[model samples]
Target: MSSNLGKIDVEVEVKSPVDKFWNGIRDSINLFPKASPNEYKSIEVVEGDGKSVGSVLLIKYTEGFPLVTFSKEKIESIDEANKTLVYSVIDGETLKYYKSFKGTLTVIPKGNGSLVKWCCEFERANDEIPEPQIIKEFAVKNFKNLDAYLIGA
Candidate 1:
């Protein structure tokens, strides 16, 4: 890692199967806003088909959500066989603090359930800025909430 780069890895256990969790994440542009309207207002594809690599999405957060109001994200990679997806922030309020921000999500089968791992890589715009702990916390909470929603669905 570079001197200016910061990384965060968080894992949450889910009652859903690995495939189910992976599918849900792949479809998050629709599911996230529907499942947690308080956190996400909407996610829409701005470029390409939302399913494949190179798709760009604009994500709007709810008014009172912390840190950022919206983000423009580009899908960098998708490995369905490995249940991994990688995306990078291209534009947003987050860009004011980060020179670059990328996230990888992977779902792994664990016994009867699954484990969702979220990894974030970011470069701060300046030394005075804090690490992206809020983003990590948001991801963990989102995973828990989405897991519960999936189980009930």
Candidate 2:
């Protein structure tokens, strides 16, 4: 990584099947707020059909979520065969501290469950800015919550 760039990878092992977990992530616009209403206020597609590359999603975080009020992310790529999705923060309060930010999510099959991996690549605007550990924690929490939701469903 570059001097100003940072990368973090977080993983969560869940009881939900790989297919189920991957499906939930792909349909996050509808299931995220339902699974964790306290964390996500809403997620709406502002561009594209919410299913393809270049789709832009506006994600609103609930009050007291300890992060930005909202985020605008653009879908860069999706590989269904590999069960991976890549998105970048194009416009959001996160940009205030990050020169650039991108995230990639992948789901892998495990014994009767799934292992979800989240990788965040970010460039800080200044050295004083902290690494995005909060975001990584949030991703781990979201995966666990989503896993519960998928298992229940």
The lDDT for every candidate, in the order shown, is 0.92, 0.93
- The Cα error of candidate 2 at residue 76, in Å, is 0.3
- TM-score of every model versus the real structure: 0.97, 0.97
Candidate 2's TM-score: 0.97
* Model 2: per-residue Cα lDDT over 3-118, one tens digit each: 88999999899999889899899999999999988899999999998879999999999997885999999999999999999999999899999999999999999999999999
| Pairs of residues at least 3 apart in sequence or in different chains that clash in candidate 1 | none
Model 2, residue 115: what's the lDDT? 91
Candidate 1 TM-score over all chains jointly = 0.97
Model 2, runs deviating above 4 Å: none
Scored by TM-score, the top model is 2
Going through the candidates in the order shown, the clash numbers are: 0, 0
